[model samples]
Target: MSKRILILTTIISLVFGLAFSGIIFAADDSYWQDHKEVLDELQSDGKPPTVIPVELIPQEDEATTALRERLNEIIDEYAPRIIEMSDWLYHNPESGYYEYNSSKMLGGELEKQGFEVTYGVEGLDEGYNSVIEERFDAAGLPTAVIAKYKGKTEHPVICFVFEADALRAPTREKGAFHGCQHNMQGPTAVGAAVSFAKLLEEKNIPGSVWAVLTPAEEIPPPDKSAMAKAGVFDGVDIAFFSHGFGPTSKRNEAGLGNCCYLIDAALYDFHGKTAHGSRAWKGADSLDAARLFLTAIDMLREHSEPEFRMMSAITKTGNAPNVVDDYVQIDHWNRNTDPAGQAALQHKAEQIDQIARGVAMAAFNEVDIRHYAYYYNGIEYGWLNALMWEYVHEYGDPEAISEELGKPSGWAECGYPSVNFPGIHVKPAIAGTPEVAGHSDENADLTISEKGHRALVQTAKIEGAMALRLVLDPKLLATVKEEQARWQEYGLEKGLITEDMIRK
Candidate 1:
């Protein structure tokens, strides 16, 4: 009987140990098992897929032919200036928020082209304007530029967003370069705006063109969504935007199928009385409280949602080894895809604070917690995506361009930019292979290559055509506006349109 009891106790202990060690066994019956042979045949052949160029001929109508001819002529006329702008931006890169020269330069060029200019329109801190006037002679806020060309009254407002921030990665001369291809943004947007403005003037097209130079898209202290809520896009009818994605040209057809994860970060500080290491029992140990707090957080992963992610770094942990640590600071962050998931993660974070407090109380210490950053995911517009694709095929030769650029495919794919507006994010190919993945020095260099220049010209043409098309067809604008209304209603239900996201 005793032996049987011992055996049961051992089994229970083993089970508990495995659970604590994050070892779990689950049954697997995947559908892939039965289709391995067929799936294997579809595996990669170590080469990019061939892209067949789909050159769409405009509809055989006088209006369509005229629009196409005008688009072509505008591209031919502005090609040199556009390429020069891109080259200049490539040589001179600037980081986010501090894009003073970039903004001034781009804004000056827009003003030269007869667009009404507005400068220094971005400030984010609470009471920043009021406080700065009292403390300092001037308010030093980040700079952004807005250029407008009013064609005719009562027409659709087509806005183009130009991001003028470079990446601060390791490769550049001073760890600040246009690695994210933001250098391409200015040329393409300016080219499109200039062409569209000319078309409207020459043909009396009834529409307005507004080109916006937003500061710090790469790392936004004030991101695009914040800019929108701050009235940057107040009277904008629709926005035209694009990004670089490798050497292939793609469009977000289904809008942002999967949006960027919402992230929030906070700092927690724990305080205790210091004492000698030998006489540690006489004083409270803040490090002890921090340890238990982090342990609880690690244990939380087992029960948290699958999409949740959390990480922490111990920035401060006392002064000397001989004395008991009195103060400790922890910086932690959490991320999730949706609002509910983000809320859940936030709750967990709060619970961690409580845990810290509880542990501190037991150790006769105290803790202070403060949250610093919270980034919400932007909303997507699907209806606008379809319209953008029409313009892409109308103006682009995906296959021929892909072959010449040595890209894998000419087909346009989808993407999600964290901005709350109805705009199409197109990725036109630059020259050469993607040496580095995502945002790297290699990608930055490609932005200045000859192929990159061609990409700038083509993208401008595509955007120019799209902007013109929207003005010509008011029905499309009405449909998009309807879709946007429905989306806003849905977003309200999902907690996307919170009080903080709206302007007073």
Candidate 2:
């Protein structure tokens, strides 16, 4: 074995041996005990078995290996701060487009780490600005935070995207809650970015690190998509995102493919003249139009492809039963797996718009439809996915480790940016954690638990290692860029992306 591989083996053996003996960092003892086969396999080969095809994996040189070690050390050094930040976000939850304090806290931490922090995106289109003003009573996205740390060179800029918005909790006493565990994302990305930045400064590496804190993930009008359109991701070469703990205890895998469905969202407003309850026939009822619109949309389900989905919510209705309703507003979301299904999604959206209009006309109400958001499905890289999977298996909770490799699952955030550049979302399993569904108080509580702390550190280590590899290996970076370009072409050919999505 080479010296680097030998060193890696020794280190793995030492860490596992300590855990086995009930010495240090033994949060999941039963898991370590059950995974002795994995340890034996690593000890015999000095390298972890390939999760992806061996050819697709990048080989690390001595220099790159050393830099990776330093990166992990930096992440370790910042683990306390990382956990603290996550906990703070958990306690102080804020909803989308209103995460002012969350932004300040996360951005403040980055600023303390010597990053140049900027708040909010400039030059957003009038429509987006109007939405912001109408929704949150803010002029622009006041909570959007962008922090940059440039090294000796600007090429190969690495970006980290973070979400800090909490889900609205109408039932609970708190108006907003970190049920989705977005509280973990900002700290995780910040931890990784700050560590990578430190490595670049110390090693005098030529690159740039950007940590973009986007708000309103759980709500409509996806912030990353808006940010992408506003040129926030213009110069970013590659990006990385991290989320809360996984739902499975088995090893999670990553591969080439899209992660989520494409979502097209719109708001429909039905307007009519109000009339007294005793003489309701004297005026048209907007509520009737809204109900008809919803029923018509439901009728489309049978005609839609099995993968297509629609969700609608009535945000406004009649104020009193005694008076005819003058106005009704419905927010609708249409979704489908993309590239192959983009046309179907577009058709369905148009049909839904037509249904709204038809329903309004039948009810003698005027309907206004506003297209608010479109979340495209983004691409993933097998090489990066494999790299992150390897780190996840290495440092992740053994109980959560799955022996099976995952298929290509595309990223959801910054789908537009994913087409423009290469990116991956790192989702390492929290150690000794049980299966927990997202957008729950249980998941949010786990963000501050022992498993959550361990996962935070592991995620940062994985992200820093991946970023270091990209920084140290120019050939790998080039290969990634080429792969992205090919995927972009495939997207255009497959009707997954339009010519307009291609950045100049």
Candidate 3:
């Protein structure tokens, strides 16, 4: 009986030891290799892998471990450089559709890194796309440049756009500073792209990375829709972009909005008679026509949604105030909560424009309205947002990003509806601050704080990681294709929209 008991004990101990050994094995390459199929299936479900991550594998990849260790090192090493770029941009602020120096410098940085640059792509029939500035020394207009790094495979083309074109600088000289922290985003994007290329060159990453420096995200015009029209993203397997926030929170809210306004802009020219001083009666008042047009638009606003936004900048006014101005140019933009609402607003704006033309005719001779740009809002990529949420939580403080801003931080989600979209579920914003971690303040302070550089570094690593995964992780890549296909179908089912609709 004692021998039988001892034998049973030995058997139980051996079984327990074997189970532990299996777990250990799972932590190595075997774990990922073995569970690859399971993970592929789970991709459709859109959940994180239930299987445990492989252990010791990270240590095995010396390059990956080095990258993870000094991931922030690059951002830190280059953060000051990013700050220099941002500070320069902040001091020399520019408005939408006219950012010359900013674009040049931002794109030029990539050139220094041996990236094949494309300054002006055809199809954009506009002046230029300076989302944050109107300062122009650029070679061409309506330009969206790309820094290309060709790799082993064309199938895994990952594109990243720095929508850092903005007029911000929350605490600095306020007109058009890096207030939106776009300055940070653009340079950081460049750094990330550069780093990605470096990795491929040094190591053996199979995919390619295209660092796209896009303009006109901050101040999207209602009529101009270059991004949507360019079809630059047609062949992209994965895309990564980033935005700024106050330093109060660390994590980005895993929020999703099914719909969003792209960009639309319209300019109407009211032509009248320009008379000499004291010859007011001789000249019909075009200013009155412009005023009438303005009034008509104001009236239309009352019928629009509370969440909707309407703004106008007098792009071109008369050369002189005393002269009975012969021409008055009005530039207007609209941002609606959803596609239907945006279309409705645009229809209403057109009606108002006609009324304005009639009023201009009453006050002047002729009225001309030109569709400056058309932006059609489209679907946000669920996979991308899901990926972002996964990354944001892993790296960021949940409390920081999960909160909402009150009063006047000026983040209106009505148009950029990704906030409430169902694809990437999000928690409500619980709190906000003007301190570190908040969107505006934190962005402003990132230059001086380690936290800020960390944020930038983390974003870069995740982007690079995703880029790496696109080629290395075949199972993950299939899931991405599934999501992208679904999104494309959904965008199609909804009426096709142009940049004009995108603005509102």
Candidate 4:
């Protein structure tokens, strides 16, 4: 072998495994050849996986049938008020931590229904809260409003979560709006909780219901996972999180098979000394250090897995082009679909802290790095998902929802609550055409349209019926808990979640 080739081979063997390094050296040419061979073989003999038929099985018990009838009546009576509340929220949008009015409206509605209310829960970044402070003339700290309905006995504590904050839609009215359809979430949750609460009262059901109003779901990087650990889910038997679907002309499908992405955000700050442009040698340049760090990130991307993602923005630098920059900051957000994948990518990102130091050392500067956010992907429980599918089928036609304009909804940050408390992450379509995108002007308009109001009422009925079933059926609850236990064991073995990671 040539001397240069031998050295390159040695380095590859030393630094990376043969499989990964082999791809680096030979896959570009060999991949297509392998791809063609696989394709030819598949064409000759491969068969697709078998598809299962969807059955619309109804709950046939006499008591269950009676319960369903009552739930329908409750939804019909209360949906109009719930729809009005959603319309009000759409017109008056608030962003993230500054959702004071939005929070108040949701909390007040529950309070009127005889729920005890509490405010201000923790687990969000200080910087995010600072925006609310500046804009609202208030402290703008991270907050979650909780409402509790105490039945005869609190044996089973069921919780429902609602996301109330709107998105930061730049150039829109008030610089914020319900582009994400969060306005639908609060009203829907409240409607469902109130309906379920009434049923418990009339039947003297011996269990409790909690309405947890969570904010800032659309604005991430600093996720609200810690809030559950902070006691919001204390004594909770199960928790449910539901949201509006993305834009799809077809009706949204009921699914728990979809895996969400693990996400995190980090910041790096480099410090140096300022100097005149003419006397550049007199001081170090933080901007040079920052640029070098970003270049290293670009190089790392080439070896990264196809599913791993990294996005960054340079936040600040020197004031003038002529002067050496004394300070520089770069924000990085990354995501991965699986636990093992997330671990590897996070390790690689953490290495950038050392890389920042190395680059700053070369540039005669100092560096500081902080990992500001961490969120795990949602866990799926087969029994919980099956239950949601049953409710979706019972309340409305699953085929109709799928064929209509609602997007097929998947998991989001609600996994935090799901992990700590076993539940389904529901996506009910409230408004918007397939052409309307989320976090946009058209989506905001959809929230106030007549179709939007109709859809919101239907969402309430579905979620309310589901919540009431869990409250009334002990056998069903047992089945769900068993499924969750099995899923937890699998997650631990696969590194999807850790014992320490779950809230006690």
Candidate 5:
């Protein structure tokens, strides 16, 4: 570990009173096992494991308290509209990159609240555009929305990034549906943005607010990563994101760490000559190359570490079995929990690529490879995450709030943006909500329910309070930025991020 990381770990140990074990790199499967043990230990000792000691977290002053009260009132007044927006999205679901009606409604709501709205973003690379056209038969992301509300000043541009795209049904004929409750994300963000902007105007605060309506959380190429590369998040000092609420009594805790697996995705195309199946020896068989490549990937698992994962699909191949396949396209994704593991994952990916080449050579076939997307783990700030968690518990439904904190989130949408500025993914629990598997019809149904409505309202208040505090207290924002700088440096040292990413 670097000196800075050791110092930060020492601070974390002092503040949270827990050993800081691999804060950035300890998120593999075994990490979860250890996390469960900690929870069990806390339960046995009759202490809240997820809660940070109150004295360690920053306290709200009278002015901050008054502002939060007013922010809550603003969001409360907009509660009915917020619920309606969420319900509307639930009823009219659209797939990724095709969220026309969804974006219109969300952007319209922002415009009604005095934000300047833009429909589509520029700067998506041509390679991504070509891929989208080939795969989804779409030209560009026409549904992405960027709405800005300027207060007395533009410094400290606080952004609320949210998604509105639904999952594509099992088949295209069935169309799209909100199996992941993405319908709730847009409204939750809008409610926060509108209320925060209103608060800014009402109190003459000097800051800016942005509501970024990102599409296609369930599909790739990831829209957020593409947008970040295109400079969509430029000049934003901080960002906030939210997801669907979980079951009741679930503690929502925040900490400095990455969530979900870092992903590297690519598509491989093999080209060969066609011939009759009976005379297959007379022609190169692309299908044989693709099959060999997949077999090699399967064999790779035996040598891969427990944290590594690989998924692939044959997206395209010749139709008739009577004839040798002339072309085959395989889409593949490799994943790992630790960002530092990316280098090893890349080495593995190169091995897979070589396997494809070797198979293609054996089959007398040519190959084309396109590395389309890279999703890195978000660099989380401990202070910001803890503060957001505190606000969620403070404004959340009492019955939904767990006496103990839940496991720290290991994934977020702001992975790309985290390198540039500070951000948090706010997770608030809903009361009386039954836990259902994500990306299911049952989970989708919860978005329009009474529990969902309360969650949406509470989340808005929570995010509003968090943003309000940042705007009200400059020192707090500075502290957050300082912490973010240290984490970014640590990420670089760990090889989780590159210098080019920071420059971008």
Candidate 6:
């Protein structure tokens, strides 16, 4: 009986040991899976974890704790005002760059906080770029504005971006309403900034903190490329940004880096002369070319990728429906997994133009194709996001975030920034805090729930961590790129690739 008991005990011990071993092994595998390509990053930095003084990492210190309390107090104090603003903004959902009132109110709040506010700054045309920067991305529109926080630290500068854009109806109305919850990003970020600024001033924290209020995120022609051309990132070592989402979504999701694809692109414009119906033969039939162009595009649409997307605007079809129409121009925008795929689809545009040319020739007219507003996607920075997301899980309300969507563990997809950036770590993010079936149609309270406040607290903590991470160890920047390279290698092993990547 004693021998039998020993045997059972030994078997139980073996089972327990195996499970423990598996847990430890799994952790290494997870870390290795992400940092494998960056074996160099690990190998090069032979510093032992114990010796590394990451203690100075800006976190929820007593100062932060005190600041948060004060900030919460202020939020409570200003809850009424925020409710008024949120309700008004909620009722009036402006699409993309038309957020005039939203922008104006935000600018006013910042100015009241002692920020030398500027309206319509960094805007491409009237797009808007409000800079509280001791420095701007540049002395121009379409730039990031960083508010400098005075501080003493080994770290120098860090940025917190406030995205003041939203998804809206095509109608150019102020009350279009916030569909994607981009309206939350600005206030959450600014709220954090206010706390950080107050903390810095009250406690004399040493380091530069910038509350960068950026605009024009969702416009059809995002102009990110144009903004890039404008050297928006010339001097910046790191870029940190975030958007809002509905609760129970993938909030702290990381791994795979974010993958996106472009599906198709084309450009077709036709020109012809007009004449009386009786004298039709005497005039060029612009209507005929337009009709042919539409038919060709429609035919090609049938063969498009199952999950593909396409959109184009008839910028100019004709001055009037009468007179047979003199000239017409249609702007084209297309997407695909990669430019090569986009190119293959765009080749079909040649077929379209060939048909248009033939029709124009027969009609004694002309054809011109001008392409504009082309786009490529983007990926989130790896180490940067990993740290931000991981830190959030560590500090944020466990009950606030959900685990349903996005990558549960691992990195974002290697390629596809356009789509990936928006969805990376998408699960835990809250659209408006409540687990409502539909999106928020919030009033003055703008659906600001307790969960919403929790989300804001988490966001503030994440931003603070990112800022501290960037400033404290500038090397973290390179670590981020290395993480991306690892993501790319994993994607290659899995036959993954990014589409429409505009080469720098």
Best by lDDT: 5
- Taking every candidate in turn, the Cα RMSD to the unseen true structure, in Å, is 16.2, 11.4, 12.9, 13.5, 7.9, 12.7
Models ranked on lDDT: 5, 2, 4, 1, 3, 6
Which structure is stronger by lDDT: 2 or 4? 2
Q: Which portions of model 5 show Cα errors greater than 4 Å?
A: 1-54, 171-174, 248-258, 275-282, 337-340, 403-411, 498-500
TM-score (C-alpha) between model 2 and the true structure: 0.82
- lDDT at position 343, candidate 3: 54
lDDT of candidate 5 over 84-139, digit per residue (tens):
99999999999888888999999999999899999877878778777877977655
Give me candidate 5's TM-score against the actual structure. 0.84
Query: What does candidate 4's lDDT look like per residue over 115-142, in tens digits?
Result: 9998886543455444345334434244
Roughly what TM-score does model 6 have, to 2 decimal places? 0.65
lDDT of 6 at 395: 59
Q: For each candidate, give its TM-score against the true structure.
A: 0.70, 0.82, 0.67, 0.78, 0.84, 0.65
Once fitted onto the true fold, the runs of candidate 4 whose alpha carbons sit more than 4 angstroms away are 1-60, 122-143, 170-174, 245-260, 275-282, 337-340, 397-399, 403-414, 428-435, 498-500
Give the worst 10-residue stretch by lDDT in candidate 3: 405-414
lDDT of 3 by residue, 1-504 (tens): 124323433443333223322211111122234455654565433333322222312222465456544544554566567656756665565654566678788788889888888865555444434421233433234446777887755545666666545554344665564546666666667867777777766666566778776665565442113443445444555556665445343222211222245335666778888898587999987788878877877887787667567777777677786788887777776655554444565675677577767888789558776654444443444344444444455556666664332211001222222211112211111123245443354455553345544555556656665555444544444443333233333333344332332222
Worst 10 residues of 2 by lDDT: 24-33
39-93 in candidate 1: lDDT tens per residue? 3353234111121112221233579558857877987798898888877877888
lDDT of 2 by residue, 138-167 (tens): 656889999999887775688988899999
Candidate 3 vs candidate 4, lDDT winner? 4
The pairs that clash in candidate 1 are: 53-399, 250-412, 250-413
What lDDT score is found at residue 235 in candidate 1? 63
Top candidate, metric TM-score: 5
Name the lDDT value of residue 403 in candidate 1.
Answer: 24
Candidate 2 ranges beyond 4 A from true positions: 1-58, 247-260, 275-284, 321-323, 337-339, 397-399, 429-431
